[model samples]
Target: MASYGGVAVSGGMPRFSDTLINGGVILEPWAGIRAYASYAEGYTVPDVGRIARAVGTAGVDIDDYVNIEPIVSNNREIGVELKRGPLDASAAYFWSTSKNGSLLVQTAIGAPFEIQRQRVEIEGLELNLSVKTPLPGLTLSTGYAHLIGRTDGSANGIDVVDRDLDGANISPDRLNIAASYVQGSLSARIQTQFFLSRQFERTPNAYPALYRFDGYDTTDISLRYQTGFGALSLSAQNIFDSFYIDYYSQTVRPNDNAHYFAGRGRNFTLSWDYRF
Candidate 1:
């Protein structure tokens, strides 16, 4: 990816390019068990002058601007799966670390700029399970993930937490479940996701607090008819059109006065596909 654009807040011109390569391998050493691992590397150009100028406007004082260096990261993960009869389960652990990490730092003046001197580390675990029963048209699937991140190096004469240390904006834990049923040409499915409240550190004296939002549950039903000319189907999303905030950002004042991004209300679609 390459971008040639000027900073909106600052008048400085910015340019960047990145190349990424990722690959993985899988091996089966025994019955009902398989293992896999993968790695990826990324190289990118940095615009240090643009970043410095932005940060300077944010109330930081710097005598000179320095060009940023390329950023790099290394990631590795291993996992195994087990299958038996009508049930299957899998789990994996992953760790990733980055050097010369590029991040936008905000200064007291509220100016934000990119910096490539920072380092970051992240680790996570994931688990998935699926079961199919003999009972006609019955299938269930569920999964969970937990992630933690932190800075690998010190910054601004303070020990910053590796993960969004300045704020509580990290998506740490997630749970999801999905089930589907089919009878002849008719099918129905229900899926729901739950995200734990996120914690943010508002002040040095005060501990982080979790902001809560109602969990999400959505159901979709669809029917398709087979025809000589084509096939037509209809579907609906968010059938209930639950009223809730999908996302939000905090304000300087510790109040919930932040604007909320609304989720999709009730929506329907009809699709047709034909083969010549």
Candidate 2:
């Protein structure tokens, strides 16, 4: 096992600082069962260019811009897995907190510039399971994730509100599922996704602050063929060509007719790969 920590400084800026520590232990108190755990912590300062972009103003002299304090994030995660015969499963949880988190604040002119005083917190849990059945050449795998986010000292001090909706954007819940079948040199896969109902902030002057959207569902399919020399693959996205809007923001001006940017329709791609 090995662990390390160090610090250094260069240029006219402050010295760099970081600390990392990790160790793993394998336990086999019984046959066919295993357990392990590891932990780590690290830190780093922000980039000079990012700092400049966050505080610099348009049409102003670069020399006039001032440097803001560097931001930092602390992250942690832990996971465990179990396996027995053809079945295997694992679960993990992660969380992160930022001091002076960086974010982009939209200007009155409709462009997003950077801001650093904001703070952010994110937490999530994930699980994965897979099984191989007695049936010859058959396998099944599935996974899911749940995430939550919050911001502190926002423009309106509203916690748990969708920051993406600040400009009248809407955030929706998402679900995804996929499966694949394999035989010989050919394989096929199919996937589907669903988005729950969302409400967008309309052009403040023309309509109310919110516009509800009907949820939409979409599916995709793909097939691939492998030869001795190369492999050919093709896929179609949004195969159902379901018409829906992925994102929308309130226009700066209420009377502006072009307030929404439409989402894409059905799309396709094909490619071939060869190895020497």
Candidate 3:
């Protein structure tokens, strides 16, 4: 390790210190109905691995490659919530803007990756609902999210190729449904999640083609029992052994032609928790 005046090299382990503020207001104008609005600022630093593996110009020292700016974003949202008897629901719309956004862009299908410095805009809608059945200790819940993201077509005030931001590790649409039951000390729950099709990678300098990921879903179930001494639980994930790919595995690399990594198959787990 190298150092400068008691500071270790590698930019002192790439430290990032940021301050964020978020606030919201909820108004219950009448019984069982409420509305809210929120504003928040988000900040994120680049991954150290992204820096280490970044494709750099020849003759540049590794230490010099670690210097990169962080991404900062501001989010604004407004929503309404309802809680009437056995029904609970909420819906919201949000928009976000980011400057100096970090995106992975490859020159070709199997080429190395480089960061794209640009502005980004993301807008989305979210809806959630949950209802408790008249039946003893049973409830059903469902949720959906739709996202539309895009990037500014300018770099340094010059027009460049603009593209959708739906991919790049983010799916444009998502859905989830779950049902749960509770009686005495026993509880059971089951859930399924769906991911809508999304762009996989931004491939430029090649044929103008659409690169996307197919939609997929997975189901999981769990049961738990509480005892005097401990708790016992059992779980089955991807119950049907659905074949899929990891969300972030579409990056272009030389050895692989941007083939995605497979998702986990069916698996079962059991465990006990002891309380002291």
Candidate 4:
């Protein structure tokens, strides 16, 4: 239930309607654990083609553009779970808060983008694991993720701006490991990924080396073959072809140099699935 604003049809703009209130709850005392909690409501608006090409004022009339509203959010979560036999695990934590939040200030490569309107906060963490390897059908898995954000640029109240939340809008904590196998009909999979390296602590903002994010690692392989009349698949991605430069093309670096891209060296895919 969401309805955003700003529409033009003999209208002056500014409309908002919401009927949100998410929910969650789970419990299992002990016997293998399980616990949870949750709440949510969200919205986002303002990207009308990057605010109509960064509005340079010519015929501006989207209700006079008063910070282009809508950025309402409030989310929370907590989790825990663990299965007994063959092991399986989980953990989750989440947080979000927003009040008019919007930021995309990166002007100076070809300029045109300075939209700061703030009061934002985000936090996240996730962990998962699974194991069931007595070799009968093999399975092993691992996962990890983390995120942090900050912003209090003060549009009305709170002021303690440390800014931070770049890397093209957060994303630089990663780890994943996987292995799976299924005999009969032939199936195989292998995966690996780890991208963790970030640094921040250089006030006086404004493209401080794009907020320093440099970390990379990757591996992937997959194979499948089934008989009678269908299924044949093979996949290989980044198979040790690690070149770096991600996190939103190195901090959304505006223009030129094709936005500095360089990550993609090995790739292969083959598929044929037919069953009719």
lDDT of each: 0.62, 0.57, 0.73, 0.76
Q: For residues 124-147, write the lDDT of model 4, one tens digit per residue.
A: 999999899998889999999998
Sort every candidate by TM-score, greatest first: 3, 2, 1, 4
Q: How many residue pairs of model 2 clash at the backbone?
A: 0
Of the two candidates 1 and 3, the one with more favorable lDDT, higher being better, is 3
Top lDDT: which candidate number? 4
Which tens-of-lDDT digit does each residue in 191-240 have in candidate 3?
99998765532423232233455678999999999999899999999999
Root-mean-square deviation per candidate: 6.3, 9.4, 5.5, 19.1
TM-score of 2: 0.67
Q: Which stretches of candidate 4 lie over 4 Å from their true place?
A: 1-28, 36-77, 91-93, 98-105, 110-117, 123-127, 136-139, 142-166, 172-177, 180-237, 240-245, 264-276
Compared with the true structure, the alpha-carbon lDDT of candidate 1 equals: 0.62
Ranking by lDDT: 4, 3, 1, 2
Error of 2 at 273 (Å): 0.7
Q: Give stretches of model 2 more than 4 Å off.
A: 1-15, 20-38, 42-50, 54-70, 107-109, 133-135, 154-174, 195-216, 247-259
Q: Write the per-residue lDDT of candidate 1 for residues 106-198, one digit (tens) a residue.
A: 343332334535666678999999898787777898999987666633455554543443333235477888887776655666777666445
Worst 10 residues of 2 by lDDT: 1-10
> What TM-score would every model get versus the actual structure?
0.67, 0.67, 0.77, 0.38
Query: What are the per-model numbers of colliding residue pairs?
Result: 6, 0, 0, 0
